[model samples]
Target: NAGVTQTPKFRILKIGQSMTLQCTQDMNHNYMYWYRQDPGMGLKLIYYSVGAGITDKGEVPNGYNVSRSTTEDFPLRLELAAPSQTSVYFCASGRNQPQHFGDGTRLSIL
Candidate 1:
């Protein structure tokens, strides 16, 4: 627990099945992000990476998918699993602004 850390905080899918929501950040700062909090609206970005192999795609990347290679992992791939993708997933970082989340991952799909 140095900054960002998320694991099976909670999950439940059955529409298609496929999970991989794990993010790590030792406060190295490298512009990393991944958001999805649909319940009232606000966070939406789905994938983002500014280091380690590099990656991009925000504002909801379809079923979702992401990776960052190093600088403290950054995984988030949800193939299938519908039901509007449930919601409640946050993993972020920063290096020149604001961003620091993790403590969310409540997914549910029936």
Candidate 2:
């Protein structure tokens, strides 16, 4: 079974464009999160959900959004993508246990 999966491993978006980064897990986790890491910087939480239909904005939620509609899916949407939003995006899920992360999506905005 897949622990966690993210689509579009790499993408290039023009400024003002938008896209949704897909994330899904088969582990039936209750907690899910989205984070972004800039070059040489630590990961900054973008958004998170403790369960389906319950989501909260994280440290750097600007320009991004997330929705958790099921135990297995948490999708991150980037609205009007900007150059500053260009970074590697990671999705993670877990219960009370340690989180498992997705491979990551490398996004570049030009």
Candidate 3:
């Protein structure tokens, strides 16, 4: 069974462009998170949701947003993409157990 899936493994965007990174899981997890990792750096949380109809910004939420409308999906939206936003993004989901990650999406802003 698929654990977690992410779409558009790689993408290029103009400085002002916007896009959504899609993430889905079949584990029926209630907790989901979006994180970005810069080159050679650790992951930085962008947003997270505990359950359907509930969401919250994380440590680095600028230019990004997220919504959790179901137990199986949590998508991250990037608005007004900027060079600083260029990085590899990862989506994760879990319960009290260890989180499972999706194949990261690589985003480049030029």
Candidate 4:
């Protein structure tokens, strides 16, 4: 059922280019999350939503924006991108303990 899907598995952007990382889930999870993982570290939460029309900034929300318009889609927006933002992004959704994750979107800034 395509539990979690992300677009543009790989992307390259200029120093100030902006892009949106798309994520959608077919599981109808009320909880959706956005995280970024650097080369050698664990994932750090960027943003999260408990349900539609509700969202909260997580540990590393700087330079990023998120909105939960529907239960299935939660997109992460990067404005005025920078080199420091180059990392692997993951989108997850779940109802409880076990969460489902998308393969990930690898972003590079030059």
Best by lDDT: 4
Predicted structure 4: clash tally: 0
lDDT (0 to 1) per candidate: 0.86, 0.92, 0.91, 0.95
* lDDT rank order: 4, 2, 3, 1
Query: Considering lDDT, which of the candidate structures 2 and 4 is the better prediction for this target?
Result: 4
Of candidate 2, the 10-residue stretch with the lowest lDDT total is: 90-99
- Across 23-50, the per-residue lDDT of candidate 1 in tens digits comes to 8989898888888899888988888888
Which residue runs does candidate 3 get wrong by more than 4 Å?
Answer: none
- TM-scores of all models? 0.32, 0.96, 0.96, 0.97
Tens-digit per-residue lDDT, 30-83, candidate 3? 888899999999999898888899998889999998888888999999889999
Evaluated at residue 32, the lDDT of candidate 4 is 94
Give lDDT: candidate 4, residue 53: 100
lDDT value, residue 99 of candidate 2: 80
Candidate 2 at residue 86, lDDT?
89
RMSDs, each prediction? 11.6, 1.1, 1.1, 0.9
What tens-digit string does per-residue lDDT give for candidate 4 at 1-84? 789999989999999999999999999899999999999899999999999999999999999999999999999999999999
| Residue 77's lDDT in candidate 2 | 97
